[model samples]
Target: MKIPIAIVGCGGMGGRHLLGLKELASSDMNNITLSAVCDLRRDNAEHLADDAEELLGSRPLVFDDMKRMAEAMPDLQAVDITTDARAHHLVASTALDLGLHVLCEKPLALTIRGCNRILTAQKRSGKYLSVAENYRRDPMSRLTKALLDAGSIGRPELFMDISASSGNQIIITPWRHKKNMGGMLLDGGVHNADMMLYYLGDIDQVYARIALWEKTRYRPEGDGAVSGFYQRWFGEMPESIEATAEDTLTAVVNFNNGTMGQWTQSYAAHGRGFGHKVIYGSAGSLRPGGTRNGAPPVLAHDGQDEITGSPLLDLVPDFHLDAITSNLFGADRLASYDIPFPAADRKLLAIELYELAACVLNGTSPEVDGFVGRRAEALCYAAFESSVLNRPVSLDEIESEQVGSYEAEINEELKL
Candidate 1:
């Protein structure tokens, strides 16, 4: 079954989706056909259309408006909504009403209310919808999750995921600095939030402290005439820029299962870095001892002879996701529930998009559906509120109150 689909927003991420879709169509498992590509800018949309034609031997229709795209291609089965976070709800709602399934980019929407708008539309339309969160879909992440589930760690008690980087970390994008889209914590942090949710489960409460360590503004500073490449500005030399987002954040979370999790984000770490993911469990501890992806996850047990699995023997670095995928989809069909995504290279984004396409084709719920996306987003937004209120915000507090401070600001600013 082929799922005819159009891609919206032909910018950075949208372009990636275009490539993935083309790859999926050309692959042996070929299941999705790219029918059209859309961008707010015509040139961007047309450029991807040309690439699609070159890759697939047929040009996809191009449109500046999504409704126009759908109207133009009445047979379009679904849309890969790769627009900005703020525009996700509006675009998805329109597509949902038009009876198109949606595979939206992360955060689903900036505010909880905004997210619910898409959910309501999906409920009314009965269309398949999923959020493309690819972090946890990566091979390494999946391997870690498997080990945890296999009892390698023996009841994880605590987990710490930290990322410390230099330059291009803080100024993710010009609009990100302006805070039109969320910020570092919500915009970039949504991936972290999803990863946390994958391992730690639901968060019961969150307490956070946020900071704006490096106040930045988009400025033209290149050659004396201001003609140098600026990575922070997405290779653009904007004359002026304003900031409203928090760049540094630290948060502690209490899970409903009585486990604790901590997350820290800092864009101001210019040189030396300290970053790692360590899960301290009752029976064993795991630390990432090396930088290469080929290195196996380090495991150290407190000499517990009863738990007799050798770490090196158990956690081999060479086992790819393909091994498991091939088994589940090809050999061990009924014995396993794992979906064999076609990309043997373990391209996480392609895996995620393939999952969405599979759902639309086979009539199954996506692994990361809209509800999962919203819950992860809620954690990020709730962390924002916790930072402001200087206390742990319970999940019930977020559920009881229809609109939190962050949600209110987003609705007011974006007029959602």
Candidate 2:
């Protein structure tokens, strides 16, 4: 039987999920039935409903409230929670209470406690719950992990990610600049942090310095643009609002393997936007973010030292590192896993939808469960604490409730 599903929050991310569902239904995958699309704005919901009509020859029920939608579609087995990070817990908990499996967007919630609430609700309901961490499920990410397993870069020693932005705020949802949404890290950097975990495993410790270098006052978006990322998505605000969340963050992540990684995120940066996920290993180094530059996604170091300029060779673009026996070994290490082609973000969402259905039909656990999502969120919080406290904060310290930041504000925002 086809899984009855709903797409909540018909915004940018939600639209992506909608298209993904279209792909599944159009392809005769029959994996999901687009039972509904819910958004705060009636137009957004109706728009996607029309798009579904065009694509699947059927329109889903439109809703502005999730609880009412759940009550209307009692048979809905799943819901894709692409609402704002701040409202994820509210929508997800409501869906869980309705006995619907949930596929929520990244960070799960603005605060770890919010994530815990959803997690607790999921446990009580005994239903499937997954976080839409597409970065971890992306093809490039999979290739990078396979290469790491293949030891193309032996014993990872150092890692770095520099995500500098130009006109970044133009794409940002205004609420992201506030304390409740955790400013930059929770709003966007969760993807970066989650990718780090995907590559390096769990973080052992974190020492971070977060700051708002540019006090550029941006008024809340009014009548959002329609063609760009920020289009038709940002929440409406009264007027001239100032944000308190940090706009820039520099963090040092210590992985359990004794390797250290440096991460820098800035939404206010300009002049030659730069970003790449580079890992320096004992034998060689590899850069996986090259696909953005139209270069091979997987490149191995040709020299002994990572610091020195070394020509990257054996661009195992297909992730078949073992096939190139002349250059490196251990391709078989990743053989246990499949290497899908690099797909669009929307395609990744579609893939997640299939997985969510599988979890219910096969009686399985979600790949990125709530606990995993919460930990990633905690790392973001730990960064905030490190900055506010002006010292390194251990993940355990934050997880054990020994430390916390923005909890009161997040509680107020979510009315916890």
Candidate 3:
């Protein structure tokens, strides 16, 4: 029996997920029936419903509210939430209360407490909760982990994850610039935090200086081209907007395993923007590629030839994509791929959807469960707390609620 599922919040991310569902339906691992698409905006719901009809060969029921959808379709077993960062807890907890398993987009929630609210609700309802972290699911990420475990780079000692964008353009949407809505940092930084955790083990403490370098961001005038995947989901924009979210961060991350790394990112950078995620070890260093799009991992070993491309695959002979991922992406053991952005993105989303179905059918836990999501989110908060207090903050302090001065306002606003 196919699990009956729905995609909620029919905005940009929701549109991407619809594309992903289409990809999943075409794959052998397709298991969930997209029973509905819900959104507060009726037009958005109807727009995706029309797309679902054309793409999936059947129109899903459209709803302006999720509760009404649940009441209308009692068999609805799962919901994939693509709402804004702030709405995750409300929507996810509601879905869990409706007895539906959930697959929520990353960060899990705006605040750790918000994440816990959804988690506590999941615990009470005994439903599976998955965090849609596509980065770690990338084949390159898997291979990188395999190589690290195989000691291709020897003992991990230092990691440098740096990203800088030079501009004051509105990032994605307007709400992303608002602190109440989780701003640009937590909105995108969760992926970084998750990647850091994926590469290095648990983070111990964070010391940082975070700043809102861009007080105002201008919306692209006329039809100015935007960046990357966001262009696909661009919509109407305001001419100018006041930005509340901090746009710059430079932090030192101390890992539990004694591995230390620098995490620096700035959208307000003025000079040539640069970005890279490289880990240097005793023997060599590795430059990881971007997620989903099958970029090859780069490795340089001491007194040995630099290895990359297909040859990098030799380092981890036992490394291979899971059965589902292998079939979906059509490469089980390749080190690099040429699949384009949104296409590759859809495949990763299909993998996430397929995993959700497996958990529902096989009674299993999701690889990126609620707790895993919380840990990633807490690291971002730890940085924020550290920045506010002007001192190093432990992940334990942030997780245990001992140091949440940074997120107190967000938590209070949400009533979490």
| Descending-TM-score candidate ranking | 3, 1, 2
* Model 2 vs. true fold: TM: 0.85
Tens digits of per-residue lDDT, candidate 1, 1-416, equal: 77888889877667667666655655577678888888898887887788788878999888998887788888998999888788898999999999999999887987777888899999999998899887665544555666666667788899887877643343534566545577767877888888888876888888988877666554434433321112322445455555677777789988887778888877556788777788888878765322113234556688753321234434544434653233322421111123234343234556667787777777778978888998888888778788878888876576545438756777887786
Model 2 spans > 4 angstroms off: 167-169, 217-230, 233-241, 290-295, 302-343
- Model 3: per-residue Cα lDDT over 1-416, one tens digit each: 57999999988788889888899889877898999999998888898899899999999999999999999999899999998888999999999999999999987999988888898999999999999999899888998888888888888999999999958888768888899998878888999999899888899999998999899999875444664434545656778899998999899999998888899988888768898889999889998866967778899977888789888877788888998889987879978888988788888989998999999999988999999999998999999999999999988888778888889998899988
Best by lDDT: 3
What is the C-alpha local distance difference test score of each model?
0.71, 0.72, 0.88
Model 2, range 234-289, lDDT digits (tens) per residue? 45532445667778889999999888989998877878887767889987777874
Which candidate order results from sorting by lDDT in descending order?
A: 3, 2, 1
Check candidate 2 and list the clashing pairs: none
Rate residue 186 of model 2 by lDDT: 72
Looking at candidate 3, what is the lDDT of residue 278?
94
TM-score of 3: 0.97
Better of 1 and 3 by TM-score: 3
- Mark the 10 consecutive residues where model 2 has the least summed lDDT: 321-330
